[model samples]
Target: MSTSDPYVDLRSRAFAIAYQMLGSVGEAEDVMQEAFLRLHRTQRDGETIASPRAYIATLVTRLAIDQWRSARARREQYVGEWLPEPLAADPSPGEHAETADSLSLAVLVLLETLTPQQRAAFLLREVFDYPYTEVAEIIGTDVDTTRHLVARARRRVRERRPRYHATRQQQRRLAGRFFAAVEHGDLPALEELLAQDVAMHGDGGGRVPALGRPLNGRQPVARVLAAMAPLLARAGGVRFDLTKVNGQPGALVFDTRGLLVAVMALDITDGHIQTIHSIVNPDKLQHFGRVGNLGDLVRADPDPTGDA
Candidate 1:
């Protein structure tokens, strides 16, 4: 790869599209590598490329759609709730609000409801600001068909997307208060930070114990957290570090040995926590660093004396 090659500069943009389309960093990276390889081969064969950007984007979109189709069956058989692999950083923060929101774990989860072609069209048109004609070219559909795909996807997303959006500063502050309440086992404070219909989702991939279904309602969610606070403390060597996950206020949990054990992303709205997404599946945490055996943490012995 030459430093002067435009592909070098387009890597990040290409990654943003691939990641959003596939919702898996590893898979998106694989798509990028393959796309670049093809590009290199074509150039080496003395082919004249008019627009490297559009050409690469088309390659990435098509490749990601294929990957998504193949992965569908595996995801269908996955144990427990399924969540997109959490992204540790925002790909492009200066982009428009729609692009930023599209990166959220919440939105990505909702995007799973659409067909692969619909998802590609929607992301290209709505999030990346691609025109319908270009989106049609990328997805290999007629312009009218592409418009229909985008409209249908937009409708589906609108029905499920978060109604309220929070600023980064607000998310950090609320997340701090929410986590503090959890750490201290303050039931009232925890409940105060959550909305009336708040929900908590956990994805353990059947390797560790997790909520088989989303736990809903503020009181139920708060009670569970309060009960787990002492258990987590008793587990010993557990640490929680505040950080960003999927462009939202979240935390990275580590064991005594400093291995990542889990990730938690919060969805805040109207100055309250609306949803909590927790990923404890070891397979998903490998990208972060070494992963600890979460089962050990979850299996910690409780106080035998009727006090716990």
Candidate 2:
């Protein structure tokens, strides 16, 4: 089997770029297909591409940029909240570091704020470590413009980022405490774990009775949790399973009937859970069959194993 293709090794990389840019597996796969088509059509013309991987990357980025623009418009028309698509675990630990670091859930969600060019430039430089000149070529822009775009994008990210420095260790700890509070239905414990200005947002698309708008302030969040306690107690012995959503610590819950119920994600700031994103809308939980890990489960219900 002699194949004249160097890009066989690059599909995952191309897919990664598209997924980060478009936030949809289907869209990413479509963009990658288009990129490969372009390569097949252009390579036969005796065009000398230094790196097939880089060439394909440019094509995927362009396609994803267009898709992102349209998606943003659709999100604006959405009935309620809009959320980033969730991702499952890699299952392969060897590839984990690359996928985990590049697709940090919070970072991907934040990248939604950038313009296509800004996002391409910033991600290439920051995530891929590409030089300005190289990134300029990848994005089909001049180096000066690419530099400026990356700079502006970086500044915007810094400004919008939570005040506390985010680290995997701190996120793990906060997730642990969150599970403890939810399991016990302790408002004070829950309140103490959340920042005073903590907020929770969910994009269940009106199917689930979410807060509709972002729940701000610890008091309001506490009240909501308290109100849900009886329902959680009565809801067919539901259990939470800790999982990673989009590579961040989160949870997925299932009722006793073995039906998926909720997907919860969080953003930790200053050692407290600053944002609690609970996705109770059933329509959105179709792709994910299970939570990412134990942290992901416990956040949804106290019993992740569904044995309770």
TM-score of every candidate relative to the true structure: 0.93, 0.81
List lDDT for all candidates, in order: 0.86, 0.72
Give lDDT tens digits, candidate 2, residues 1-308.
97766666588778878888877777788899989988888878878777887788788888888888998888888756776666655323545453465565566768888898998888778766778888898889999999899999989987775544677777777787787677567899888888899887766565554555777899878766665555566643466677777666777777766677777777777778887877665555667664222222234554222222
Model 1 per-residue lDDT tens digits across residues 1-308 = 65585566688878888888887889999999999999899999999999999999999999999999988888999888998889877656468778777888999999999999999999999988999999999999999999999999999999899855777788889998988887778999999999999988888888767777788999989988777777777777477799888878889888888989889999999999999998988888889989986667757643211221
Give the clash count for each candidate: 0, 16
lDDT (C-alpha) at residue 234 in model 1: 72
What C-alpha lDDT, on a 0 to 100 scale, does residue 147 get in candidate 2?
87
For every candidate, C-alpha RMSD to the true structure in Å? 3.2, 6.1
Model 2 lDDT at residue 110: 80
